[model samples]
Target chain A: MRKLLPYPILSLSLLVLWLLLQQSLAIGQILLGAVIAVLAARAFAALEPQQPRARKLGSIFKLAALVIVDVMRSNLAVASIVLRDRHRQQTAGFVVMPLTLRDRSGLAILACIITATPGSAWLEYDSVRGTVLIHVLDLVDEATWVDTIKNRYERLLLEIFQ
Target chain B: MSEVPVWVAALVGGLSILGAAFTLLGCIGLARFNSFYARVHAPTLGTSLGSIAILLASAIYFTVSAQRPAVHEVLILVFISITTPVTLMLLARAALYRDRAESSGDVPLQWGEDIVVERADAPSEG
Candidate 1:
């Protein structure tokens, strides 16, 4: 089973995306989509990458919800800061936080979450030092940001990816 | 476009306008911020909430009118969500790298390169 489809999720999602793009589920479209998906999977398999095992699928949904809410909240906060708070004593600065999660996929997810938020951006991550440098546009509390990243996202990511 | 009802038209138009406004705000930040590092955040507004609102509008409009569950807009959403961050990260890394090459004091010197070699007595003075 693994031999035929090395990355089942990737293949399925690729097929779905192809179908969604075509916006038709005809027999020929299905066949062609399947072929393309399998080919893409095979091409990806050629890279011989480490397969990240999601230990807990339930946590993934929880994390997604958390991210959506955070994104919404931050969007409002950043917009207000940009439009009105520029003159105030607000400070934009860098934050370096220690990271415990080792999974590459988890780190990638973390980077995505940090960057997607309007005010915060992931500057760099040092795998050797296990630290990530982030920049905040309206930085008020450094410890709070660090705590949020560590507790809110990293903890759940560790549970899911580890 | 003419056959559509007023409310549906209003909803789609409203969403599209909101998305465009968000995108414009993102660009404003790009111009408003002083530094390159600070300006890097300008695109997130466009990518996240902007794309989301516009994509939702597209999906809602097509699904209601076409009467066949149009999800092609979702493809754009997924593509935008995945690619935006990666592009931002790469652009950031490149910008930081370029900035540091000029020996500017804003960015860290030892960033971007992997593997920080630490030794007991190997010139700790900076």
Candidate 2:
């Protein structure tokens, strides 16, 4: 079964996405989508990358919800700043944070979380030292940002991926 | 689909224009940012706020016009939110590699001297 659908999940998802975008389930379209998916999956197989180990599925979903809410909140906050006429305040600055996430996937997830948040960006990371530099568009409180990143996202990611 | 109202169409058009403008702003920021350390902030603005505006417009318009919940567009937003930083980290690692190889000024690279980098063109590399 696995050999028959060598990239079972990928092929299924690609076909679904194709249908969603085209909003059609015609026989010809399904066949074309299937062919493209299979080809893509074959190309993917050449890489032979390590599969992501998701240890805790429930925690991952919860973390996803948390991230979404935070993203939306920050988006509104950022959009308001862009729309505002205040030229007096300069809201951008750089920050350095000490990190505990030594795992590659965990760190990757942290980087994504920081970058996904509107006010912050993942800059440079020193792997040996386990410290990451970031720039914030709206620098409010440095300690707060540090705490938020460390507690909110990093801990969950460590549990899920590490 | 019923006869589409002009106001809703205009709103969608406006939101789309805003989204595109934000995306352009992000690209400009990416270009203009001085250091790799500073440059990472630019694209996040585009991906977060810029894409949100576009996705919201999509969800709103589709739900209204098609008369159904158009929640699946959230997946794109999720994908971007999760992937952008990962790519940025990889790029930063690559940049750090090149910089350290050239022995550039103050790169904050603490990766140790186990890997030796020959200085062939010192003046140009830095």
What DockQ does each candidate score versus the true complex, computed on alpha carbons? Answer: 0.60, 0.31
How many residue pairs in model 1 have overlapping backbones? 0
Residue-wise C-alpha lDDT for candidate 2, range B24-126, written one tens digit per residue: 7666656754556545556776887788889978887887788777767877876886677777667766776687889884565444464434344455856
Return the top candidate by DockQ. Answer: 1
Return the clash pairs for model 2, or none: none
lDDT of 2 at B110: 43
* Tens-digit lDDT track of model 1 for A74-98: 8777676668645662477888889
Model 2: CA > 4 A from native: A80-91, B5-43, B62-126
The most accurate candidate by TM-score is 1
Local lDDT at B114 for model 1: 26
For model 2, residues A1-162, the per-residue Cα lDDT tens digits are 655467888898888777766666799899999988888887887888667777989889989899888976876665555554546226567678999888787777777777777667776778877888876777788999889889898888889887
TM-score, every prediction: 0.91, 0.69
